[model samples]
Target: MKKDLRFLVVDDFSTMRRIVKNLLHDLGYANVQEADDGKTALPLLQAEPFDVLITDWNMPGMPGLDLLKAVRSDPKLAKMPVLMLTAEAKRDQIVEAAKAGVNGYVIKPFTAQVLAEKLEKILAPAA
Candidate 1:
């Protein structure tokens, strides 16, 4: 993963956002931003350029899935990499995210190593 790449961490809980931000910082990604929910996140996404998006699934309004769909549908943001870091671990939910074009998915309570691995996988060039 590019150390300088901009990241957007979206979650409803402030503590969760801070935890994710801290993890990313530990992983050597310093340029990070936070959004409380997808409704708030959408505009930032549209207004700015973010290399990666790490979002939770259960937000009050717009949720992560809807945000992913919106990003996929928008021509400008269509190619953006989205990594779902959510507590929702249902098989169907994972399948739906994959079908919707998520670059990666990590269930909550993930370790820093898991996050690093997922980032590497998503950012890796196609073989």
Candidate 2:
């Protein structure tokens, strides 16, 4: 289902970024890009088209919550599906992300199966 999808992975850690990229690749999404932080991700978002966004909540520059808000508020990218992959499991944080229009959420150290399930659900064909 993800063969034609484009994914943007945002994280402060290069290792984490590579992990997400590898997961996306293993899931059959070959077209994946990486950003070290929300600041970098924003420009990439503006210059390219990504079908889905998987971002970490905490970063040095712009937090993922703010990035989520920005993406949702932007007319051109507002409808893009976003999945928050973060270590922040706080109830309020989750609530905020949901309110910001995140399509899915996953706590850190999650299984690839769980990620795949969320992606499949979010990208399911409209009946």
Best by lDDT: 1
Q: Write the per-residue lDDT of candidate 2 for residues 32-104, one digit (tens) a residue.
A: 9999899999999989988889999999999999999999889999999899999998999898889889999
Model 2, stretches more than 4 Å misplaced? Answer: none
Q: How close is every model to the real structure, measured as TM-score?
A: 0.95, 0.95
lDDT for model 2: 0.90
Q: Which window of ten consecutive residues has the lowest lDDT sum in model 2?
A: 118-127
Worst 10 residues of 1 by lDDT: 118-127
Q: For each candidate, what is the lDDT?
A: 0.92, 0.90
Candidate 1 residue-wise lDDT, 14-126, digit = tens: 99999989988998889999998999999999999898899999999889999999999999999888999999989999999999999999998999899989988887762
